[model samples]
Target: MTATAHETVRDAGRALGIPDPVTEAFVRLLRPCVYPCLYEQLPEESRKHAGPAARAGGSAHLPVDVVVPAYVPHLVTVDCAAIPTDVLDIDFPADGHVAILAEITDQDAGFAIHVPAGTETVERRPRETEPDALKPCASFPL
Candidate 1:
């Protein structure tokens, strides 16, 4: 039996240590905008680079930045990052238009997703409060 493009993506996500929920969300969100064939052709090396960062968050619901190499046709080497739904403030099953945030230059267009620290509900609370939470530790006398 042949694996569908979606399955390939899921497998890739698994190999990268991305949580199942985030991977499923990515597959569902990008299904309409991205071609199926592209998912099948996702490079192995790029997946390696993205895996560590994706898993660094350690939460299934946290938004992930999936950077696909040559995402746009004829734009080889210019990767595009897929923005997760949470970052865009979109709800599931809504069928809303997805946006790809890109930096376009004369030579190339590079897309990226920036999820600031402490933005997600799970990460909002600090694991351990410092003596001076508001100020940097370095600012105080040793």
Candidate 2:
């Protein structure tokens, strides 16, 4: 029910280990700052099949945030810049991933983040194959 592959990726060079304390520390700082800001895109952006709520709300209402906490770090925007609730979000660089989670709803699903395209990735997780291939998994419905 939690993010297995996601967590596994943290120790890419290693077989199975918790992400380093430094990485965890960064995660602590990063997750809360990003979730609220970026979660709104889940429904529309996900290529996976959307359920009834998405059909009713159109592509704009994917509710994937509820499950993110157990698996991924949640970062709410830290800036005091008065970001509109709609604009609050987290962005993931390549070799890393981010999720903007929605509050728990009847349905739960959200979008994953990485550099849009052709942008430099400053920070990335340790990986065996690629350093910055930040990919996200979907919560397939039961």
lDDT of each: 0.36, 0.32
Question: What does the lDDT read for residue 23 in candidate 2?
Answer: 49
Error of 1 at 93 (Å): 25
Q: Which stretches of candidate 2 lie over 4 Å from their true place?
A: 1-6, 13-19, 32-48, 51-142
TM-score of 1: 0.23
lDDT of 1 at 61: 23
lDDT of 2 by residue, 41-126 (tens): 55665536422121111112213332223322222212222222443344323322222333344555344443233334332222
Model 1 spans > 4 angstroms off: 1-3, 32-142
Alpha-carbon shift of residue 82 in model 2 (angstroms): 24
Name the candidate that leads on TM-score: 1
Each prediction's Cα RMSD?
A: 19.0, 19.4
